[model samples]
Target chain A: MASSKDVIHSKLWQEESEPGDPFTATACYCSGYDVYGELLHKASYVDYLYLLFRRERPLPHVARALEILTIALGNPGPRDPSVHAAMSAGVGGSPAAAALMAALAAGAGSSGGAREVLLAMEVWTRCGCDLNAWQTAIASPPVATRQLVWPDIDHFPGFSPYARDVSIPVRQTLEALADCLPDGCARWLLDHRQAIENLVGLSLAMPGVAAAALIDMGITPEAGEMLTLLLRLPGAAAHALEQGEMGFRRFPFFSLDISNDPGPAMPKEGTAR
Target chain B: MNERPPLETFEGSLNTTMGGCFPGERAVFRGHDLHAELSDSDWIDLYVFGITGRRHTPSQLKVLHAIWVNTSYPDPRLWNNRVAALAGSARSTGILGISAALATSEAAIYGRQIDIAIADFLVRARRAIESGRPLSEVVGEELRTRRSIGGYGRPVAKSAADERNAVVLAIAKKEDLVGGGYLKLAFEIEEFLLSGRWRMRMNYAAIAAALALDIGFSPREYYLYLLPAFLAGMPPCFIEASTRPEQATFPLRCSSLIYEGPARRAW
Candidate 1:
C-alpha cells in the first residue's frame, strides 16, 4: 500500500489565508476570478453559476435570458413528477436530503425532465437552423447504441404530450426568452414555434424551451442537463417542505392495476407457458 | 430498432407488467406477492428475480451471492466507501450517506462504469469470436478502439497481487459455475494478455461480468442488478464513524491539504 493518500486539489477553485490565521479562508476565487472580492457584488447568482460551468461570465443579455429561464423552471408545480416525488418523500417523513434526491432522480427522466433537455440540446447541435432535420428527428428519434441507465423514451423528448395544447407558461417563457437573445436559436424557436408544435401534434414543453435557450447561450447538452436538474430543484424542495407540514393525508396518491385481478405469484421458476 | 409508441399511447394511465402496492393490502414485485411469495426467499435471489424475471437454481444463486460477498471490501479507503465514512463522520443521516455513496458507485474509474464497459466488450468479443474471428483479433480490435479494456489489468495492483479473483473463482468452481463460455473466454483472454507484451491478469470485474453473462444476464441486466453491489459494506462504515466524535474519521489538519491552485491575488 502507498504510504500517503493525497491529491492535488481541483485547479478550478482555492482560497486565501487570513493575515494571522492559516486555517480560515479570507477570500475565495473561482476560475481565477476573486469570487468575494470581485464577482460577489458585481455578478448575479445566474452569472456566477454560468461561470462555474462555462468558466467565463455571460454577456448581459445572455445572463438575463438564463435568469428568466431559471425563474420559470424554479418550480415545476405539484403535478410534475419531480416535485411530486419530493412531496412523497416529505409526506413519508424521509430525511431532508432524500426529498432533493427523489426530486433529482424523478426530474432526470427522459420525459419532460433534465434528460429531455439534454436530448433536445443534442438535437439542436445536429439540426441547427433546420426545421426539416427537426421534423425528421422528432418523427423518428434515433435509437441509443446500447443499454443506458435510463429507459429509452417512448415519445419525442422535450415536448409535453400530457398538455394537449401549447400551455400558457410554455408560450410565455418562449416569447420572453426569445427577446433576450433576439437573433439566436431561442429566437428561431419562438419565430417558428407554431410550426414546430404542429410537427409533433403536441406542445413544446418547458424542457424543450429550456433546451433551445441553453443551446442558444452556447451551453452543451450535458451542462443543460445539470442546469435543468438544479433550476427545477427549488420547487421540489419547497413543495416537499409544504407537503411534509401538510402530512400524508393531504398528499396525492396513486393506485395501479397490474390487471383487473391481483396476479398469480410470478410464474414460479419455469412455470410460465 | 428502438420502437417508440405514439404520443396518444403515452397519454393514457399506467400499464405495467411489474406489480404495485394496494396501500393496506398486498404489494407485488415483478408479479409475485412481495410479502407472501417472496417472504422466505433470500434477498439476493429475489433481487436477481426482480431484474431478470427468472429465479436462479441454488448453485447459481450461491455463485451470484459469492460475487457480491467477495467484492464487499468494507475498508473505507475504497473510493465509494470513503463517501459513506465521511458522511458518518460529518454526522449525516444514514439514508443520505448511503445514497451519496451509492451515487459514486458508477464512477468513471474503478466502479460500475468499468463493469458495464467490460461486460459490453465481452459480449461483443463473444459475438465476434462465434462469427469466426479469433479471440486475439477481437482483443486487438478492442485495444485499437478503446486503447485499454476495463476488466483486463489492475492499475492499483499487479495480477499476481490481487486476491479476490482466486477466491471468487474457487467459490464458482465449487458451485460448478465456472465452465460457462464467458468464464472460459475470460481465462483465455487472460492467457493471451499474459503471453503478449500486455501481461494483464483477469481482475474481479472480468470474472464477474463473464459469470453474469454466463448466468444469462444481458449487459443491461448485469448493470442494473449490480447497482447496490457495494451496499452491504457502506452502513458499517457509517455506524463506525457515528461512534466517534463529530468529524473524527480520518481527521486531517488544514495543512494536510495540497492546494495547487492560483496564488493569492486581489480583486
Candidate 2:
C-alpha cells in the first residue's frame, strides 16, 4: 500500500557494501536475497537473464551487494573497466559473479547481452532500481559485431534501447527484454519500410535505440505514409510534433483520409469512440 | 474450505440468485464491458475476484465463444443452459464454461454499448493524433461536443494520483513522462492487458488472478497472498449473483506455495 516512493525508501531495499564494489541490489524491490537469486538461479533465470553472461558459481551476497552500487555509479557493462575489475576481484566465479559479469556486459554497450539486461529489468520491475543509469549504459557508444563477445551496439546500427535516466537499469533492462520482442532484443532497429513509415507519421515512436535503430534500419513505406502526413500538416504543426509538443486532434482526419475508415486502428468502428 | 452445493440443486435457485440489469443496460461483468467499450483493443478486461468469475481454460474459451454467440438477454438464466453444458464438460475437460461465457458474451454486449454511445467523441482525438491537429482543436472539439468521459475510472494507488492511468494517455502527456521509459510503460501495460495477466486470470490460484488486469500486483510472487485473500473476502460478486451457497463456496486450496493473506488493492 505504500506509494512507490515510500516503498523505494523502505529498508527492504537497503544493502551495505564496500566503497569500490559494483551495485547488485534487486531493482524490482523484492527481498534482497531473492533479487540475487533471480540474477543467479541455476535454471532459465540465470541462463536467459542478461545479468548472468558468464558461467560461474553465485557470488557471496556481500560481494553481490556491490551490484547496486556499481549500477548506481553508472551501468557497468563488460567493457567497463570498473566492472571487469570487480569481476576479477572475485575469487572463484559464483552465480552472483556471473550475473555481475553479465550485468557488466549488458552495460558494455549495444550488445545482445545488453538487450538481455533490458529484459531482466522488465521482469524484475518491482525492485525499483534507477532506470536512467541503464539507458545511459546501453546508449554508451556500442562495440562493433566482429569483436562481439556478445551483441553490442557497435554491431547494431541505431540500436540504443534504453533511455538514459529513466528509472533503474534493471527495470529498463527487463522491459527491453520482455517476451515476444523483435530480434530477441527489447529494442530493435526498424529496418523495415512500413515500420519506418509508422515512425515518421509518428504512429510508431518508441524510446532509445528502438526508435533510432528503427530509423537507421531503413525508411519503409509506412515511414513514407507518416512522412506524407507530416509533410501535409502545416509546417508549424510538424515542427511542434518534432519538438515534442504535438497534440492528438487531427489524427482522425489524417487516418480517415489515409484509410477511409480508421476501423481496426480506432478500436471502435463507425465513429472515433 | 468454502465449497457449496450447486445452484441447480439449491431448493430455491431464483431466491438465492439476484438479477441485476441485463448487459446493454448496466455494467454486469464488473468493468469488462465498460473497459472494452472504452478502447478498440481485441482483448477484454476481465475482473475475476473469487470462484464465481474465475479464469477460463482453452476449451472454456470455446464455450465462452459459444455463450457469447448464443444470446443477448435481460435474464441471467439465459446462461444456465450454457453453464450446465460447461459444467458437464469441466467434469471431463477440467475447464469450466462460466468464466468464458462471462468474458466473451458480457464483453461483446458492453463493448457495443459503450462504443455506440462514445464513438464520435473519440474520433476527434484520433484525428488529432493522426493529423497533427492542434491541441485546441482536439480539446475544443471534445468540449464542444461534450464528449469527454473525464475520469479514467480505474482505481490506482492513491499516492500516484498525478500519474496517468493508461500508457496511451501517458504517451499523450509525454512531457511529464518522457523518454524510453514511457515506451516501456506502454509495452508493459500492453503485455499485462493482453497476455500475462490474462493467463494469470485463467490459472485462477494467484492473488493477482482474483483482481482486474489493470489492478497491479506482482505476478508470480503474488501467490503468497491467495489463501488469506480468499479466506478474508467474499466470492466474486457475479458468482454470488448466479450460484447457490453450496456451489459458490468452492474451497480455494492448492499444493503450490500459496500465501494466504490480505490482497493489497489500490482502491
Candidate 3:
C-alpha cells in the first residue's frame, strides 16, 4: 500500500523527450501484429480498432458487439448536434478539420456524448459494482437536498430522452456478446437489466452499454469516450463533405419571419443624443 | 525488507488551488470561507481568482473585463461569427452552433493560439532587449527567421487605425497599464515593422496579447484567458441568422461555381 506522501511523489509527470521515438517508425505494432505491414491489409477495421484500444485482438463476439454499437451510433442523423455542427461548418466553406473539430467540440458537453459516457463510468466505479447501490444513487435527490452530488448522476448519463425502451436492444446485444468475455461488469450489467429498468424507469442508454462493454474489455472510461469519438469521426467527415457538395444549402427550419417594425417608436424617449 | 521513503515527500498541486469541499460542513476557496468571500468580493475577481489562484485589483479587473467587452464585434461577417451564422443558417441546435464557432476560434493564423505565440515571442524579445540587444536587431532577427511576426498583420484591414484597438488602448491607459515591458517591446517592434517596405501594422491580436502580458499573465495563461474574447458576439449572430430564412447567408448555385475541369462526362 502506498502512503499519501508516496502517492504524491509518484504522481505521473510523463516526459516525452527521454523516450525513443515512438513516431516515425517504419511499421506499427498493434494487438500483437505488424499493423502497417500486414494487419492493415488483412484485418477488419473493427478488429484493428479493437486491437488499437485493447492492445489485444478482440474475440469474435466482442468484435461483433463493437461493430454493431459503432454502426448504431455512427450517424445519429444530421439532426444530432455534432453532425449538424459539422454540416454547418462545411456549408460555410470551412476545411474538413474545422468541421470535424466543431463536431467534436459540440459532442463534449453533458448531453448524450463522450463526456456523459465518461461520467456514467465514474458513477459505475463509485458504486463498487453494486447495481442496487447504483440505482438508489441515481434515484436520489439533487445536491442541495442530498448534501452531495455525483457529477452528472441527476441527469443519469446513460438513459436516452427520446425513448424509454432503448435499453432492450442494448441489453440483447450485450447478452449476445458476453459469450466470449470473462464474467465481470458486462455480465453484471446484463444480469441486472430488469432491476436497472425498474429503478430508472427507463432502459439503459447506449452509452451505458458501451461503458460496460468497454470496462469489461479493460478499456478505461476516458478511452471509451475517445474510441467513440474516433468511430464517429468518419460519419462527421461524410456529412461535412456532403454539405460541401450541396453548395451552401440551409436546413428547413432556417425559414422564419424577420420583422423590423417596432410598435411606434416611443417619441424620442429622453433628450436625443 | 525494503525501507520506506520519508513521509514529508508531498509537494504541491500544480495549477489551481482555489476551492474544494471540506467533506461535510462548508467549502473553502483560496484559504477563505466561500460564503463570506462571495458576499464581499466582486464576481469577476472571484472568477479570475478561480482560474489563476490570485486576486486582481479593481483597475486590473476593469481592464481585463474591457479586453473582452471591447472585442465583442456583433457583425456576423467575421470568421468565427460567420461559423455561428452558418450553423444557424443550417438550423443546427444552439449547442452545436455555438460550439462550432468556438472550435473555429482556435485557428492557427487568427485565433487564440496565435495570441500565445505572439505573447511568447514578445516576452522573449523583451528579455533579449533587456540584456543589451538592440530592439531593431531583435525585431530584424525575428523577422528573418520566422518570416512573419504572429500578431502584427491584419487580414481584413490595411491600416492599424481600428476603433476597437483605440478603445482597448484607452482603457489600458486609464487603468495605468500602458507602461509595462511587454507593451513597450510590442510598440518598439511595431515601429520597426512599420518602417519596412511591407508596411505591416499591429492588429488587435498584438494589442490584446501585449496587454495580457503586461497584466502579468504567462504566454500560455494569456492564450487561455483570451479564448472567450469573442464569445459574447457569437450568440447574437447565431440568434439573428437562425430567425432568418434557411441558407439566406451567402447561398450559391451550382451554375455560379467556376467549373475549370473537362467538359461534362458520364461516369
Highest TM-score, which number? Answer: 1
In Å, residue B2's CA in model 3 sits off its true spot by 25
User: Which order, best to worst by DockQ?
Assistant: 1, 2, 3
DockQ score for model 2, please?
0.02
Q: Quote the lDDT for A231 in model 3.
A: 65
DockQ scores for all the models shown? 0.33, 0.02, 0.02
Query: After TM-score superposition, what is the CA distance of residue B215 in candidate 1 from its true location, in Å?
Result: 1.6
What candidate 2 gets wrong by more than 4 Å, as runs, is: A1-165, A169-273, B1-88, B92-96, B106-267
Error of 2 at A260 (Å): 50
Query: Per-residue lDDT for B146 in model 3?
Result: 71
Worst 10 residues of 2 chain A by lDDT: A253-262
State interface RMSD in Å for all models: 4.5, 26.8, 27.4
lDDT measured at residue B25 in model 2 versus the true structure, 0 to 100: 39
Give one digit per residue, the lDDT tens place, for model 2 in B150-211: 21111222223222123223322343322333223223333343352222111111111212
Q: Name the 10 consecutive residues with the lowest summed lDDT in model 1 chain A.
A: A1-10
lDDT of 3 by residue, A47-91 (tens): 878766765667777777678767756775686788888888888
Off by over 4 Å in 3: A1-273, B1-18, B21-33, B39-41, B260-267
Give the winner by DockQ. 1
Tell me how large the interface RMSD of candidate 3 is: 27.4
Go through the candidates in order and give the clash count of each.
Answer: 0, 94, 2
